[model samples]
Target: MVQVKLFDCEHEQDLEEEINRFLSDLEHKQVVDIKYNIAALREAEDEQIYCFSAMVMYIK
Candidate 1:
């Protein structure tokens, strides 16, 4: 079986933390693959905010 999870946050650190917590809960499962995507949410003068999404595939 395969499982997937998505996580996004205003800050990259927050997103990473959320992903970590989610993966931790699946420790009993064997992970087959993991993937992620990141994109800018809005345009700014010189900086931009980011959003992230992650997918986890595992065997049950």
Candidate 2:
């Protein structure tokens, strides 16, 4: 089976940490693949927000 989820964070460190935590909770060593894309959202000339879309694939 395969599963995908989206994670959002303001900093890179937070995003990475959350991903790791999620993987750990799954406790599956046979993860097929993990992928993600990050984009910066602009609210103002000097303001930005980070959005991440993460996908996790594993064997059921």
* Candidate No. with top TM-score: 1
lDDT of 2 by residue, 1-60 (tens): 655655767677888888888778676765778777889878877787777666777654
Model 2 — TM-score against the truth?
A: 0.62
Off by over 4 Å in 2: 26-29
- Model 1 lDDT tens row, 1-60: 666655667777887888778778776547777788888756767677777777777776
Cα displacement (angstroms), candidate 2, residue 41, comes to 1.6
Candidate lDDT values, in order: 0.73, 0.73
Off by over 4 Å in 1: 44-47
- RMSD of candidate 1 to the truth, in angstroms, is 2.4
TM-score for every candidate vs. truth?
A: 0.67, 0.62
Span of ten consecutive residues with least summed lDDT in model 2: 1-10
